[model samples]
Target: MTGAGGNPAPSLPGRFGPSFDVRTVVVEPGGSRVYDEAEWRGAIVLLERGRIELVCSDGGRRAFGRGDVLWLEGLPVRALHNPGREPAVLLAISRRPARR
Candidate 1:
């Protein structure tokens, strides 16, 4: 949910701070997948295995390898593809929205 000033409210409030939700994303060898920008707007993505390449909306591209961590917020990323011959795994961690 949204809080004052139109910011996102956390699912778990208080001392420990916000709760997080994690999702697994796997891209097969030579395969591509659309990035879920809406759900992962401010997410932290961790490359678990293999490699990942981002296709940018502005015609640019970037690549990441295993054990790499990145934030996708405000990034103009369009799609994610695996350039290697093995499947790539990533963990997307995002804040859990407050309940109504």
Candidate 2:
């Protein structure tokens, strides 16, 4: 969805822009969430609070701070971790799957 007087959401393939869904995720201090490969496919994420790190399958890691946008599609990350003392929050936007 677009913000007040902001540019409209970009067009999508199988559906319109407004058909996408947003999920708010909270990562507690020192906590982690396993990233199932398929779960984040085509997902767009925005980091809103604190800091987070993406732990890759190859034992590498990348950190992101607030206001950073992420495209996790096709990434080999194994988990998302909150490396700061406070909680980290993020918004994940993904297109809603087609219904039967």
Candidate 3:
């Protein structure tokens, strides 16, 4: 799905395996974080505080603030940037797929 800016929405990298995990991340203002496509294949991310910009491999960018949630499936995230003056906090969650 494309966001208001016409950038494709972030999606889970792949199908979740057989586990569930959650993590907290904090990024300072002007700081950026990068994730390898091979990692976080099927993860979900929640913005807990501040503002961040999600930049995709396709050159698409989207800004997200607190209360925003992102599903990292097909979204090729190149990097995440903190655009605000304050720090940005994020909650990352991943669940494994149910056994068939």
Candidate 4:
């Protein structure tokens, strides 16, 4: 699940402090997703979707298609939108180092 901002929660090991993680997420067509900022362990989340819209808390929106790579920082993510015209799928990877 996403955190307060628009980022997902960091991995279990990162709950304590700064760390990194990689994850894969899927977004169906006409569906929407949210990722909280604090949940992110300072990792950049790479997303690949099939015709979907990425929404940010600051009202920043981006449309992505298949084979597209979207990057997310440790800032709270607002929302992810799928128009529903077709099924949209997303693969997300978060990269960060474990906290010592």
The alpha-carbon root-mean-square deviation between model 2 and the true structure, to one decimal in Å, is 7.6
lDDT of 3 by residue, 16-84 (tens): 334765555667789888856555557678886789998888888899999899876667788889989
Go through the candidates in order and give each one's C-alpha lDDT.
0.75, 0.77, 0.71, 0.56
Best TM-score among the predictions, by candidate number: 2
Give the range of the ten consecutive residues with the poorest summed lDDT in model 1: 7-16
Q: 8, model 4: CA deviation in Å?
A: 23
lDDT of 2 by residue, 8-71 (tens): 3323222425677866677788999898767667778878678999999999999999989998
Q: Note the residue pairs that clash in candidate 3.
A: 11-71, 11-72, 11-73, 12-72, 12-73, 13-41, 13-72, 13-73, 14-41
Per-residue CA lDDT of model 1 for 6-34, tens digit only, reads: 53443322323457766666678899888
Q: In candidate 4, which residue ranges exceed 4 Å CA deviation? A: 1-22, 38-49, 94-100
Looking at model 1, residue 97 earns an lDDT score of 88
lDDT of 3: 0.71
Model 4, 1-100: lDDT tens digits are 5532345543433343334344545565667878655544444444443477768677888776766655555544587788756545444445454457
Model 1 lDDT at residue 81 = 88
Compare the candidates by lDDT and give the number of the best one.
2
